[model samples]
Target: MAETGTAPSVLYEERSQRLLDQVALKETDRTPFVFATRFWAAKYAGITFEEQMYDAEKSAAALEKVLVLLEPDGYVPSLYIFGPTLSALDYRLMQWPGHGTDRNATFQYLDREYMPAKDYDEYLFDPTGYCFRKYLPRVAGAFEGLAGMPDFPSLSEWRFVGAMRAFGRPELRESLRRLLEIGERAEEAAQKSVAFVKRMAALGFPSAGGGFCKAPYDHVSDFLRGSKGCMLDLFRNKDKLLEAIDKVGELLLRGVVEETRAGGTPYVFIPLHWGLDGFMSPQHFQTFYWPGLRKVMLRLIEHDLIPVVLWEGDCTSRLELIGDIPRGKAVYWFEKTDLVRAKSVLGDTVCLRGNVPTSMLIAASPDEVDEYCKMLITKVGKGGGFILDGAASIPDEARTENVLAMAKSVRKYAS
Candidate 1:
């Protein structure tokens, strides 16, 4: 590692500047640190997972405590907010907190055919309409009444007064009540989330990104079709699947354009779920996954937004494919990809973040953690296009001292 022997002295603005500089592949004082703390924030605050999900105040407070203690340059605020909302609706897609699963277990998304193979034509014809009418109602029982609602253009014509009367039914009323309750709780949590982000900023930590997107393949696979269903469609209904993927990609890009017009942060978080090497062969990835995702990345770049692509699984073989992204326009945060090879292939093209083992953070000693981070900084942080972060989110069991070693190594080695 290049050692300057300079004391650690980065204020809020300078810290933020250093992060942006690193993303832009420019020289900076040192590598910036971005930590991903999910359920771990609740544990750090000494609160039960249930309390952290239901209690907005407690959740925000816990996240603030974690950020203050760790002092990372940037962070994702609260991953705990969705549990209560999902629970209230008895959402079948995910099990979390005390609902549909163990009280202490982290959130688990169930893979089932929410949209069966037969519905491909409906989905491709009108993705938004199908989602609201067929998909949402089937996934969440509370939204079943939506299936009876009239189309948007015909609603003003009063063509469905009889359908509107469905809301008066006791069962529908009960569902609406639950929906309102969840909505109110979600809105309150959102307010707390905004306050937490501001507090992190005041404490010298900017947000890693303001919004996030999913790869189009994941957009379909994760929600519409289960892994088995999607894989089958890849063989039986390849043409329809590709068309849907392209449409979804266009829709997501349009949403990004609309959202970023006002200009907040330049970073767009993209947590890729289904495009990993294990999910498909190289040809399938290049065909079904990369095309839509590449278009999304290019669109974001065109709009001057940095696409932060979080590779969620082993992507060693896919690194060169991802390198097609323009240089200095994106950040690729890897989870299980080989870091040394990542630096070798993508080092010159994009700003690379992470590969620190979650196991090390949870099981290793502080010195062991320091040595591992030092190795990453020395090799991966050689040039300026690197940020020190964990391979995945910090688990609830991760040792505090080990987490601190990450920051310590960045300061000692990078400087």
Candidate 2:
């Protein structure tokens, strides 16, 4: 262990600086190992996934237990969804562990076209009004009553008196009541997350990131248009879709910079979806996806924030296109992308974070795990711009011995 009596504060500063140094493509003592998992920690700590999602304290404790066990160079708080907050808003995007699945199972998202094709103008011109009046009502049960309310912009001047009458609707009143409850749950969830991050810092661990956002195309695809709808829109409604994507990208950049600054961490985590090689053609990626994502990354870099982008799926084809950002100002965490090829292309451009196979951690023996880590260290971790992590995240079923072997391999090989 690197920790000793009254030395946690010292360790925290050292670990934090080491990670920052690696992000700058500078030399470090060894490649940093960051523990990036969600439900796996709950299973490791003998806690049900349901308990971890609903109780912030339990979720933090479960993750804390794993940190003590593995002692990674950097750690992220449990990225588990807050069940009570979702419940309060009657959120309909996904089914959580206990609410919709077995207590031990992870949550699942339901993908459907929540926005119609004809509504692009409404969203592009007045997104806030459209969401409060149409989008939210269509998705969340608590916001269904909002459909009856007048557009907020129309509520100005003497027209406000007439607009106020919309609240008299029985459903709208109920929506207001639920919104109040949702506000409380949201505050509680925020406090719990901040507290957990502080506690981890005190235990000699630095966070992998302080804020998280999605690629703009993902923001549109995952929440508004379903994959099928968004895919078809590439041909059917390309112009409108592109305009909406640009507007959303700008909005996201503003929120990410503000929140990341307030969170007091320089790294902003972005998990990209829908922009992978399998999801779109290379031409489509150049036109629709890469531009918006690149804009956000550049803006984040300008703000002096490092964008820790996780390419969730195999984006091997888009590697060169994605490497156009400024050098040593970002981290690209790959799921299944080839790290050796990535290193050759991006070694001087940015820091590379991962490529470890999750299946091996779940099914392989300790010796096999050690050998794979050794290969990754010598190949990708050479020349000092790599951080060790699992493919995407550490799965809940990963073997304890295999996980331990991976953590230990860093010292044996990188040292």
After superposition, the stretches of candidate 1 with alpha carbons farther than 4 Å from their true spots are 1-10, 153-178, 257-263
Tens-digit lDDT track for model 2 on 166-276? 889999999998989998988888888888889888888778767777788888888988888899999999999899899999888767888889988888899988999
- TM-scores of the candidates are 0.92, 0.96
Per lDDT, the best of the predicted structures is 2
lDDT for residue 415 in candidate 1, whole number 0-100: 30
lDDT of 1: 0.80
Kindly report which residue stretches of model 2 are placed more than 4 angstroms away from their true locations once superposed.
2-6, 79-81
- The per-model lDDT (C-alpha) reads 0.80, 0.86
